[model samples]
Target: MAPSATAVPATAVPATGTLLRLATAGSVDDGKSTLVGRLLHDTKSVLSDQLAAVERVSRERGLTAADLALLTDGLRAEREQGITIDVAYRYFATARRSFVLADCPGHVQYTRNTVTGSSTADVVVLLVDARKGVLEQTRRHLAVTALLRVPHVVVAVNKIDLVDFSQEVFERVNAEVQQVARELGVEEATAIPVSALDGDNVAERSTRTSWYAGPTLLELLEEIPPSDDPAHEAFRMPVQLVIRPQGAARDEAHRDYRGYAGQVASGVVRLGDEVVVLPSGTRSTVTGIDLGERSLDEAFAPQSVTLRLADEVDISRGDVIAAAADAPVPTQDLEAVVCWLGDAPLRPGQRYLLKHGSRTVQTAVRTINGSLDLDDLHAVPSEALSLNDIGLVSLRLASPVPVEDYATSRRGGSFLLIDAHDGRTVAAGMVGATLPTAADAPTTPEGDEAWDI
Candidate 1:
């Protein structure tokens, strides 16, 4: 594959400075936290004071070696129980790139949290114990990674030291996971063997494993380019707020300061570019863009900026501004693949609040399609969805919303199902609506009816 404008060649990895978001997923006791700790520790990203605290805590527990997982187990309950309970994020940087690492819990019950972390991840580090090989939870993680459409996957066979760093053992485990990944339509993946506890083949190449020849975990992260650059894609921005200046004096600047504020959802917006206000079908031209007081000729995705249009079109929060020539059709009835995380079973006619980006709409489940059967890695017929169930469900929204296929635009294609009664998020939904056909392949309807899986 060729590198993009900002992507660097493999040899020039350290020369290109970019921010990468990564997440870790595996079964319980797979040492996800420890691997993360190793990355931070070996890279010299950890601070002296923080290291001292971890060491002190380890001594109090009378452990021979410091429990590196203590660095990420922030919650008191997690520390007491020696497990991660929520999504813990850590920021670190090396000479090559900056990173935002989400250390997600591995328990099957915490699968929802893993989805949240991997939803926007550029690379997912999936760990499997060498001794245990691939477990049910490991396959479940692979399924979620495939569903999220993560650009890169690293199947790190951890605890290799416990397995005597046997090359045959590593090969068997890697081959098994690779076969399952291919069955899920994941064509590309990287597998590495490491012992996060011993820091072997994690940040540094291990001498213990002379047979394996591949980039270390840290090297792989540095070399893989970011999934997508927002400027190179379709322009999109969901209006978060409307800025209409209200002041004590009605001056020239104050009277004409009508702008929309939002983070660039994707693509780039330049002055005089024609854009359409979605859901309302209002067309306008970008007259001005400002990052605080600085005037900008163009603004790209991820940058928060205020935009003033040439026409006084009626726009509000939740409205999507997209390129005039290409815009998604606003629809009220939609189908999505959702991972249910509520105590109450998801049934037809169940009402909930659907939050997509800045927009929130009242929604009800119209049909409970089928849940994915992890045993067979297939979607099976089901009438209802309980906790941690991944299924296809149709929704009837109160109003129209602009949506893109999950595979097309991550920012525009993901949503949350919030419980209206308790204001709690019960599910995370991906905008693609797919089903298995008789041909043994995932398919969507033709024309505008199709949404990618």
Candidate 2:
């Protein structure tokens, strides 16, 4: 399959199967690194030199077999500590499909890393030690996946070989995983038993598990749909830079050139499409879309393009250019779901810098409605939220921002909470805007006190 017609031809994109992004997440020591290494080794993605180094290192460590974890544990600190501290990315592919894998840390302290890795992942390969069916960390990871709305989840019951490859054990563990995944709004969850160390049922089917009838891990990877198609959705592009080349030496044809350069965040934009430069509400028609030296009739999400407008409009970085018919409303007040990443609890009236797309503004936590309990995926009325806590929050912005619901527009509806003082990322937010209805969020009365913000 050629690149989508709406996509820019100047870029080299996959043609057969759309690129898939996945992340490995599990409790510490759940063999996530090993599982990832097995996938690479079995698929012949690992180079001979790398495999030899792994072998030499394993022998030096007095291990009879190679330690595949060496392939992913890159940092010296991670290797010494035997825990992944940073998110490691790896690229590999089978003839059927291409993949970008994110090996996220499993510790509770690194929950933020998981968030960063899975934020853009198409599928989250959540590993579970067959011996330890579902840990608290598993619940937390599942909650994060739900909060982020990750498209697909594969529960790999790793280390099945350690349990004699028992079908009963696998079934018991699989049941628990499916129940939790479903409760957390994951529509489809697939659980498979595998031994990452032995390469059983990872890239290929394991003959030992005769009772199990399912697609191998590699087969599943090749099977899932890439994700939401940005080309078919509503058009949106947050201007990064306003280009004006007329000031410098230029060709006669480009002397009066002025354009807005930005990556298309969502949807498709075509020449002659009516667009509104947001916050300023300047309306104009798209005159041209250029990618380097090539002129394209249309462009879609994830592609960088310089757009020319028919009218001279006041536009700058942080301004959103959107389809006029589907323009978003700018508001000073925003209701959101926040995953607090800071060590300090998120308290009401606390000030921070809110970054939405390329726009940044002074903002404060006006109120914290409640926090979600990962154990049961329920809401707990709370005055403040601590690290790794998911909560409902309302924010007051110094300036109004044009935003949409996360379900409606993933790119426009997401934001980052940056600490004003030292520039640390405090939280990740998804715009809810409106309070949840009864059907969506069941009302549970707090003890003797009804607090309404």
Candidate 3:
């Protein structure tokens, strides 16, 4: 591999610097771990003792070069089986920015882990083997990335060296990937040619790829902006617990105190700010904000604080405090897109618990609109959804909930469906998205029939 390249000494990037969170996904044996390992090594993020251990293991296995994949496959099972079984996270920093990288498993059975890893990611890096081009797993991963609405996507065409660095092959694979990305409604995705086994185009560009004219993987990662600032959004905070000093052991000054405690989900809350309590439509003015034992005039998103209101409103856990003018409306009927993760098939009329924010309610699937076909990315009619299936469904809730459109607020718009029988997570859902109409569905030669699974 390009061992001749000089290594750059790792410098401590300040914690106050901008942070970027990214996740990696690809089919098994596509060299995802190798790509990650290459980046870590080229950037000098690995400790000397760790590299020595990997080198010793490589020699014992009768290899010429140290197996870089061993760097991220930390589990005992992963080392023995030479496969990733769970999500592996690594934190490192460059002078420009700090990073939190998640190397997710590639097996189909581990799709849930991929979802969990990518749920809050600002960018998702998907790899494709230059020889295999795009496989079914690639399409599946792309669909998941699009559904989650990750801010940025980068596709790395790995193992370009295997094809002798053919420009034609790279172009063909890039075209196919772009086409699939467009079908899935991904606004933009950049494809870069790289050889993860070597260090080419990963941390540093390779001379072998003369035809390619794109930024290297690390460069692109550092350039993409992080997720939007939470303070700029509308104010929202789900009440986790009601705080009221009780009992004789309490201090006399706090004996009559009543405050709502929760983490500010978005935007800012300040003293004298007019706020509304959801589902009850009760309005009150913020009188005080307390963090720990210290009182503050204002608190912003992601900060944990206790709020004292001007009025004695009857608020409880699962209730949301929001800005008075931009508060969400409560509704019982919801149209959503879901990725079914249960072992059992998902069918209409199935009863489950819907957990939205801090609240939970009984919900039923009124209709199974359709499933997205990976072959053509169309919404084909489906009576049921199997494990790892992405589909559109309508739900009827027992009580109204204040939810914003998923496009507007990820925290307020997303929810989870739980199996009531055994407390298993069945699906992840996004609200305020329309179900595909029958007219919008693609037709076969026989005309208007469901696509076969």
Give the top-scoring candidate (lDDT): 3
What lDDT would each prediction earn against the true structure?
A: 0.84, 0.84, 0.86
TM-score of 1: 0.92
Q: Estimate, for each residue in 1-453, the C-alpha lDDT of model 2 and write its tens digit.
A: 011122212123243467899998888899999888887777666776777788898899999888888888999998888778899898777778888899999999888899999989999999999998999898888878877878999999999999999999999999999888777777888999999998888988889999889988889999998888777778999999998775455678887889999999999999999999988898999999999989999999889999999998999889999999989988888888888899999887778999999999888777778777766666767788898888888788888788889878677899999998999998999898322221245322333222221
Better of 1 and 3 by lDDT: 3
Give the per-residue Cα lDDT of candidate 1 at 356: 87
Q: How accurate locally is residue 9 in candidate 2, as Cα lDDT from 0 to 100?
A: 21
Candidate 2 vs candidate 3: which has greater TM-score?
A: 3
Q: How many steric overlaps are in each model, in order?
A: 0, 0, 0
Choose the strongest candidate by TM-score. Answer: 3
TM-score per prediction, in order, is: 0.92, 0.91, 0.92
The residue-by-residue lDDT of candidate 1 on 1-453, one tens digit each, is: 011122222233343389899999999999999898787777766666777687789899998676779889999999999998899998777788888899999998898899989988999999999999888888888888887888899989999999899999999999988988887777788999999988888888999999989999999999989887878888999999999877665488678778999999899999999999999989999999999989999999889999999988899999989998888888888888888888889887778899988899898787666778877777877778888888888888888899889888877888999999999999988887563321343332223322211
